[model samples]
Target: MKTTLTSLVAALVLAGCASVGTVDPAQLPQAPAAYKAQSANGAAALTASWWQPFADPVLDDLVARAMAANTSVQAAANRLAQARAALGGAEASRLPQVGLAAGAGRSSTPGQPVPQPATQYNAGLSLAYELDLGGRLLHERNAAALDVLSREQLLADARLLVQANVARGYLALRALDAEREIVRGTVAAYGETLSLTEKRARAGDVADLDLARVRAELAANEAEALALDRRRLELETALAVLLGEPASNFRLAPTAWATALPAVPAGLPSELLQRRPDLAAARSQLQAAQARVGVAQAAWWPSLSLTAQGGGVSNELSNLLRSGAGTWGVGLLAALPIFDGGRREAGVNTAKAQLDGSAIAFREQFLLALKDVEDQLGALTLLQQQGEANARAVSAASQALKLSDTRYRNGLVSQLELLDARRSELANKRAALQVRSAQYQATVGLIRALGGGWSSDAGVKLAGV
Candidate 1:
């Protein structure tokens, strides 16, 4: 009987080892040439901490706050802890489980010691171990470890989001500041023009209609400037909210007009697949799901367990460990799932379906990421050209506006013509400012889509924030 049981346990163990399903490591997607934004390999210099490249102190401050205070980041950290705890728990199953028992009781038996009650005491240690013949525990451990990896990727994704948001918010604030300055200049110019028009009307040189028109234009410009200022304030408050700070406490200093756009690197699309944190998260999840298939398949096999216990029983407390009062036993158990209402089968199918779904999800994310990089790359290229052209237009308009004002002062141009020149100059400046802002933001977006700026080949690890 002993030999048969040992053979049965060994056979079951071997069967478990053979039952694991196979899963292939996913390959990176094809890199598209369209994803490249520049001719130089400058993007290769991108680090996960690419936000630091801007060297903006105010931006850095806001990023620090977002990293520390963002609820999403904290939540990812909690998930990592949970995964680590689960891994610890899964590992515990690899070792034997030990327990202790103790009892003292009084018992009476018929015709025993002239019907006297007898006192008894007992103590023992018990141990049980499930032989890992089916590798179920091993697969479970692997899955749990992968879960930990997935959580780590999630944390990275969270950091990326925080940094991107900070960059965008800072960019928006700066853009609004530029727009407000342009509007203010227009308001001041309109005020001067209105004053001149009123003086001419009083001297009977210009008609009242002309003066009324100039006053109306001045009021309109002032109103527009006020509206622009309100919008700027609202953007400031929104950015502050994202930093998890009171809006009043967060202040963004207005920056001068930015003339240059950051350079983007042209890298292979395949490289992007390895750079994105969300993609990494998806890959890790897929790996975990594949491992779960093995865990589930392991359930179809018999399980082997070994147990042993040794203890002493004695009527007298002092003789508990005496040779005559001591006893020991060892046993091995094999459990074959003969019937369980098809629950095991259902579990296996569920795990397989989940694995399939995970694979599909990974592919979908990869494709979407590729699309994002391509779209941003195209936008960055076009916005840079547009910014250059707009700058030239602004310079020409500035010269024209100066000539128009001089001509008007010398009585060579009408008040309506001066107003037209002023409006044209203001519109050109506003357009140029807007184009530059778009260029800045588009550069930031391309960098973000490329996975926080670092390639897979770089050994640099992006710290949180």
Candidate 2:
């Protein structure tokens, strides 16, 4: 019997060794060494606190609130907690289960040489453990662990998303504020023109047609300002939602758009794979799927378990632990499904299908990450050129407006010429502002694409990874 047991143990070990499922070491897609777009010179590393570089105090406060209270972020955290709990359960399953039990019963004999009431009491400790001969339990435990790591990465990704959104929204709002100021200045100038035109008409020094034109321009500028006001309200309310507050209760006082843009160097493309939490989560999920395949395949083999019980039994509770009342037993159990009508085969096939799906999804995510970085880098480079051109346009228009204003005051130019110059200046300035806003937004996009500047890749992993 001892020799048989030794041989069975050796068989179990060999079965376990042979049960490994195929999961290649993370052969994630490689990237070109350098980004295709022009890299920013002297760019600093992106950090977890990506928005802090903007140096906007209001933005800092808003991001802190969003991180703490945003519904999506909170939900992600809850999911992470659940994953950890599942991991704990899986880990516990790998260890022996021990429990204490106590029971009491009374019985009466009906017919015999003598009939009497009898009482029995028993107390004992019981233990059971799976030898994991087929490695099913081991794979289950590993799958759970990988799930936990995946959840952790998802949580980080959620935080990154929230911060990126807040930065973009706040920057856009400030740009709107800046644009509204420009419109307000234009309206003031138009009002002055209207008043002067009226006075000149009263003195019969200007035609009534010119006076009407001035009044029309003032009204048009006022309408533009009103339109900006409405747009600003929409943006403000949207931002309020991001902050996880009621729109009616949250307010951001208009401030100057002086937030500094951070320099973002397009690092090596492969580095993006390590830094992105979403990609990391995808990799973990793929690994977990591979583990599940192992678990499914394990079902084709036999399972071995050990169980033991130790206790004392006596007619009375006081004698339950008496020397002669001791009771003990142990069992070695093995089970192999004789037939399941192709159930095991179906399960293995299903798991492999899922593994295949996970691999494809991971590849898609990898491709998207690359696309995101390229899109933003190209945007930033192009936006810089646009900004430069718009700036020159604004400067030229301002100079033209000044010349027109002097000519009109000396009666060398008509009021029409002066009005045209002012219109040109206003249009150029607003265009410049739009380009600036794009630059800020694209910079934030690039930072998000780069995975909020994460550096660590430490976490739970599957075997042979």
Could you give candidate 2's per-residue lDDT for residues 1-465 as a string of tens digits?
A: 999767765654554355455655465565557677856555666455778888889999999999878999999999999999998998898899999999999988898778788999999999999887667888999999999988998998898899889888999999999999999999999888888778878989899999988888889999999999999999889888888999999889998788998875544444554557888888889889989998987876787789999999999889998888999999999986645787877888898899888888877887898888889889988998899999999999999999998888778999999999999999999999999999999988877887874233322222224
Candidate 1 CA-lDDT value: 0.78
Per-candidate Cα lDDT values, in order, are 0.78, 0.83
Supply the global lDDT for candidate 2: 0.83
Q: Give the TM-score of candidate 1.
A: 0.87
Error at 356, model 2, angstroms: 0.9
The sequence of per-residue lDDT tens digits that candidate 1 reaches over residues 1-465 is 999878866764564555444445444344454544453435436555677777666677788888888777888999999999999999999989998887888987796668878888888888999998668899999999989988998898888877887788788778888898889888888888888877888889888888888888888998998898888888888877778788888777777845344566554444654557787888788878888988887986878899999888988878887888887899999879645787876888898899878878877887987877767777777777788888898899889889999999888988888888888888989998888788778777776777776455542132210
Q: Which structure among the candidates has the greatest lDDT?
A: 2
Per-residue lDDT of 235 in model 1: 84
Q: After superposition, how far is residue 82 of candidate 2 from its true place, in Å?
A: 0.4
